[model samples]
Target: MRLKKRISPHSLRHSYATHCIEAGVNLADLQHFLGHQSILTTTRYTHLTQSNTDSAIVRINALMDSIHVDWGNVK
Candidate 1:
């Protein structure tokens, strides 16, 4: 009787690592949590996290609004 499925455990572990990265957890912390021998292994999960594009856009907009530059007369 086969009690376990044929799915590979590596895939599940990859999913878990990716989820942790996306949740704002640091790579070092995740590395420890995943029991990886090297931090480089944990870094592979960084690609799963957002590229901070939203945060960068928000900051850029805020800066544009806050700046008081007079572009009309200034050369």
Candidate 2:
């Protein structure tokens, strides 16, 4: 199968990093995977878009549910 359009290696790297962040991967681990010398550099490269926020919310909700905790009642 052929891609609809060509993607450069840098684009692929960016996508990988974004997906990893969305999947709740730790920033330090992601930095290691990307071979980034500084966490600040990794932060600049990864954009935490709305989808990433939504994914984080979902993960948090799942964790709360697993623990049988009421999210709204948190102090």
Candidate 3:
């Protein structure tokens, strides 16, 4: 298979973690799924992809846009 050269047994776990993080799975929960004793270890396993970063920026902008700030009312 074309993937035989690119994939290994250990790499599967890494890929699983990446996909889960990208899918919005909680880090603590993913830590449990991976049987990691420390959240630090889980953090090491997950990575933020471009899509995730973009989605976060969009969410933040949406939240900011929804807020009604009255500069005149500020004391």
lDDT score of model 2?
0.86
lDDT of 2 by residue, 10-49 (tens): 8888888888887889999999999999999888768978
Tens digits of per-residue lDDT for model 3, 1-75: 255467787789988999999988999999999999999998887777898899999999998888776986632
Look at candidate 2 and tell me the lDDT of residue 12: 89
Pairs that collide in candidate 2 are none
Candidate 3 TM-score over all chains jointly: 0.80
What's the residue-level lDDT of 28 in candidate 1? 88
RMSD list, candidates in order:
5.9, 5.0, 2.5
Which regions of candidate 1 are displaced past 4 Å? 1-6, 49-75
lDDT of 2 at 38: 94
Which candidate comes out best when scored by lDDT? 3
Pairs that collide, model 1? none
Q: What is the lDDT of residue 60 in candidate 3?
A: 100
- What candidate 2 gets wrong by more than 4 Å, as runs, is 1-6, 55-75
lDDT (10s digit) by residue, model 1, range 47-74: 6334556756778999878867586643
